[model samples]
Structures are given as structure tokens and as C-alpha cells.
Target: MEEIKMNTIYDNEKFFNKYSQMTRSQKGLAGAGEWHTLQKLLPDFTDKTVLDLGCGYGWHCLYAAEHGAKAVTGVDLSEKMLAVAKEKTAGYPVNYLQADIATLTFPVATFDVVLSSLAIHYVADFKRLILNIKQYLKTDGILVFSVEHPAFTAEGSQDFYYDEKGNILHYPLDNYFNEGIREANFLGEKVTKYHRTLTTYLNTLLKNDFTLLNVVEPTPATELLALPEMKEELRRPMMLIIKAKNNL
Candidate 1:
């Protein structure tokens, strides 16, 4: 199959907008991993300042503040999404800023930790985004994030799904290595998301002085294991838990 840009499916503003709202499920799923990674990565976050990128409704950021984080701020390009996050994290020090990750400007070494969850996939210019985070993080600070599995995005990766009689079926997506913007409406507002392959993401982080530490995958909680569909997903790499540090 040939590669296709992210424009095909993400072209619909309505559907895309719905995806940006709380209707999106991946945020919660990825957020669960964030919770796990947090305890493992920063066990002593009580006095640390944090910046959450693409923080849809600030679930993780709020969790940090409730438990420990000295202060937390979230940034996203979609105001509607940020609005929801703002409401969800109301009465807390969690601040929300609406801006594209590409041109986001912040003070130098301003945060103790920078986190994102399945949010970086929407960035087309991954290199510049990572570099931009440098100014936001103090030395020895960690950038923790999660990403969709590349195997699912690879060409012909749908073989794992078979019909009742063993006939394989799939989403029929081409351009598995897509790198482009998906235009859509998020929360009734026009917005676009950029897509880049996993390799490009890794290379960009490495180029930006990020040192990889831990890469993890989520394990279903006891509740999810009872569900057949989720149980099957455990056999493959569905998501990634990446812990990286910017030496500078």
C-alpha cells in the first residue's frame, strides 16, 4: 500500500471536533499510563513544577497537583479542548494555554518536568516541537510521553485481525507512514493535527538532545482483562511509554 497523508480520514471537521472533545477515549487510556509512569519516573513530584503539553482537559496535570506537583500548566492548540480541561481542573493552579506546539514560546528552564500523552502524534514538525520544550525544562528534567504503536500504523499491519472464518479485514488505510495535517473541527471549532511516523519522532527527540530512558506499554487493569477486545490488544504493542531527559 502506498503512503497517504493524514488528510484523508481527518478531513472531516465534525468528526475531528468530536475527537477533540471528551468523546475522545485515548486520552483517558493514555492518561492511565501517565499515572503509572509518574510514580515510576518522578516518585518525588511533591515540590516539582510541571508542564503538560496537549493536555486535553488536564487530567494528568490535575492528578499531579492533587497529589503533589508544586505547580502545573497545560498547553494545547485547541481552545475548546483546553476549555474543557480548564473546567475539569478548576480551582487549581493548573493553567491552560491555547497554542500550537510548533511555535509555543516559554521561559528558559521553567519547569521541573514536561509531560505529554499520545499528543505528540499530531505534530508534523516533531523536531522543532522537541527543541522548543528545551527552554521549558530545567537541566536533568524529564519529558515523559506516550505514542500510538507504529506496528498499527505500518503497512499491512492489519493481518492480526481476522473474520470469524479467519478471513482478515481492516480499516483499509493507505499511506501507513503518513506525515501531514488532518483538518477537522474540534469542539465545534476548526483545527488541524499533524502526523509523523514513530521513527521520525524518535530521531527528532534524539536530535533535540533528549536521552531515552524507559519505554513502556500499558497493561490492562483487572477490569479490562475481562473484556475480550482489550485482552486481545495486549498481544501487540498498542502504545508507548517513553521517558526522556534533556541534558541541556
Candidate 2:
């Protein structure tokens, strides 16, 4: 399949403005739940060279530096996002770069750990991206990432059928086998995402010689349960986290 160039909705001026106003943890990653679970799967960063693909706002990059990573590089497609990340990571060891994760290149075996958070789904050819990722990691280096769950993305709409009484009847699962670009509403604007099956996600890593370490479909934490909106997450997974080792 031909790769789609990433022009993420995050690059939209209004969306970036709104997104920039939110706290890092609130937007996603850190605090608890799936984000916290993904963090637990990471290897120690002490003195390790780390690279973050699609590193929005450089939260993970900053975290790696704070945890004693010798060097940290953050790559993102959005100039606005990279600017924010650069400003936020000032005085830290993190280096922010503006580049498309799908097409970015790096020296072979340059990093001990590669991380991406809530990204990668925007790329049309994830298998190819995984292959590129393998070339950038050292032997036994780790690749950790999170993306929208196949089950959730399969529908594109990410909506549940509800009765007139406003109760959810059931979650739809049509066109699950049809993989490609999916358009949906996000923060009152239309956004695009790519859908891939669970098999594709796992098999691609295996085909690229990556050893699968762990997979997680996060459940809401105890504190999150108090929020009504978070209740829907209990019914179905919204995200999938995977950790793999470059065994080359």
C-alpha cells in the first residue's frame, strides 16, 4: 500500500490552540489508566539514548531526560507542536525535530529506546514504518507505542448506537476487515485516522524481526471511574499499547 503523508488534525490552527491549552496528562499519557500502563512497560532510560516519534509536546521526551536518559530526540510533523515541545523542553537535553514519522530517516542503530504515544495510526503504511523503526534501534533496543484500538478504529465513527432514551444499545463493528483511512469528528472538527487489524499490528512487528514483549488494552483507573464519560471506556478499549524488542 502507498503511504499517506501525515497532515494531522493537530496541525490545524484552532485545534492546536485548543490542544495547547490542555495539560499534558489530561490530553493523554501520564497520570493513570492506559497511559500509566504504557509507561510501566518501558525499560529504564538511565543513560540510554531515546527517540520519540510523533512526539507531541515532547512530554515523553522530557520525561526520558528527567529519568536520566543521556540523550533524547523528539520528532513531530506539526511545526506548532514542535515549537511547543521545544519551549517546554528548554534547558533539558531533549532535541525537537520537525519531521513526518512515516518518512523520517535516521542513522542505523542510533537509539537504545524508541517511543511513540497515541500516534502511528495516522500513518497509512504502518508495516513500512515498523521496518524503518527497526533500522533505527540497536540490538535488543525497545520500541514502545500506543495507538487507537482496532476495535475502536474499525468503525471510524467511534460511536455507539443508542436508543431514543439515550442509552447505548450496542457498539458497531462493521467494515472491520476493510483497512484504510477513516474520517471522524474530533473536538468539533473532522479528523483522519487509519485502521488496521490486531493481526496486522502484531504480525508486522514479527515480520520485521521484532520480538513482542507485551500488549495492553487499558482499563479506566479507580479515580477515572468517577467520571461518567470514562464509563464508556470500560465497555470497550479505546487504545492499544505494545512493547517490542529489536532482536537484530
- For residues 1-248, write the lDDT of model 2, one tens digit per residue: 22223485667777777666653435645444566677689899999999999998787898899899999999988888888789878998898888888989899999999999988998889988998988989999999999989999998888889999999988888798999989755555667889999999999999889999999898766776776767778888888999999999
Q: Residue 146 of model 2: what lDDT?
A: 91
Per-candidate local distance difference test? 0.67, 0.84
| 1-248 per-residue lDDT for model 1 (tens digits) | 22323333233455445565541245564425234444566435688898888786677788778878889989876655676778888888788887766678789999988888777766776777788888778988988887665554443333365789976454334565766654433344444455456677677778778888876766555555565655665666556677888888
Query: What lDDT is reached at residue 235 by model 2?
Result: 85
Model 1 clashing residue pairs (backbone) = 3-175, 4-175, 13-185, 17-185, 17-186, 57-85
Query: Which sections of candidate 1 miss by over 4 Å?
Result: 1-39, 156-161, 164-199
